[model samples]
Target: MAPENTPVHIIQLIKEITGFIQKGSPITYLGCPLYIGRQRIIYYSDLVAKVMKKISGWQSKILSVGGRATLIKHVLQSISIHNMAAISPPKTTIQYMKRVIADFLWGWDKEKKKISLGILGNS
Candidate 1:
């Protein structure tokens, strides 16, 4: 009900109509964040971070290219499928996911500015 910069909105319940309770924006439905209307990408950062942690664990392991691709295509994609179904993901969120997947697929080296997309000796 308020702009992005604005703070909390208060709701006063009617003493006469003592049946329902009032809730606010940005509640979680199932595992996804639920809000009345459009929300910024930052809200979903924690969800993305959860996914990143999953990928990070796998990053250290030695898996074949096909295996990695499968995880990306199936597991990674499915993680946010429910959230995406509920609402469109912000551009930044999508980009962040892509970057994470790409980095996981091709080992990210601290020295290199960009990942090599190294699929040469995948097996």
Candidate 2:
């Protein structure tokens, strides 16, 4: 595929030489979307879903809070780092991930214990 403003003759020549069909942008490359235009949260939805899936999978396991924290640091973080390093994810996505982690650590029932994440982090 040719860049914007590329002459039609040149594009035709390249297509003829290589017999390649032209395609559009927004294709997934190395598990990341490569496209021109403004970035949107939708692009990173997969990353969010991945984090949720990982956390949900562990819900069945009986683990201590420390174990949950370890999984968050090692497993969840690793899953997101690749996409995060490539592009900045929306704050909403980050917040959702944090909330999910906190819920997993403290138990889903609000009445169980409602502690600020900052406070939880210190302890």
Candidate 3:
């Protein structure tokens, strides 16, 4: 069973990933005249907000289901979206950024024996 509470490593990982992604394409506000000579990048807030909305909807659907395993299966099946979307945004894509962020924040990384330990307390 998944533990209750956010994980630290996952949080770190999320911060890292968010940093990496944002670094590659730093978003600039539209009509902002301060970047007249600079190249414009995609906005992180807009991308993140959209991704959050998609994940929120997905979580609601998962809750509607009765079984944890079913939720896991569905999530696994959609894992590709999570990884790919991080690198490239697609049209009408509902990537699983939330799950990735949540897992890194709360899930166990058994290989490294590193648990998030946000609320689980030194697993």
Query: Candidate 1 vs candidate 2: which has greater TM-score?
Result: 2
lDDT of each: 0.70, 0.75, 0.41
Give candidate 3 regions above 4 Å deviation. Answer: 1-42, 60-100, 103-123
**Candidate 2 wrong stretches, greater than 4 Å:** 1-25, 116-123
Global lDDT of model 2: 0.75
Predicted structure 1, TM vs. truth: 0.64
For all predictions, the C-alpha RMSD in Å is: 7.3, 5.6, 19.5
TM-score of each: 0.64, 0.67, 0.24
lDDT string for model 2 (6-106, tens) is 99999999999999878766665676777788877777777778878887788625898778777877887788777778877777767777787778777
Q: Model 3 — which ten-residue stretch has the worst lDDT?
A: 31-40
Deviation in angstroms for 110 in model 2? Answer: 3.2
lDDT of 1 by residue, 1-123 (tens): 334664333223342356545456666676687765678787787679878888977854689867887887788778888888887878788878777777777667657776445432221
The candidate that achieves the highest TM-score relative to the unseen native structure: 2
**Number of the top lDDT candidate:** 2
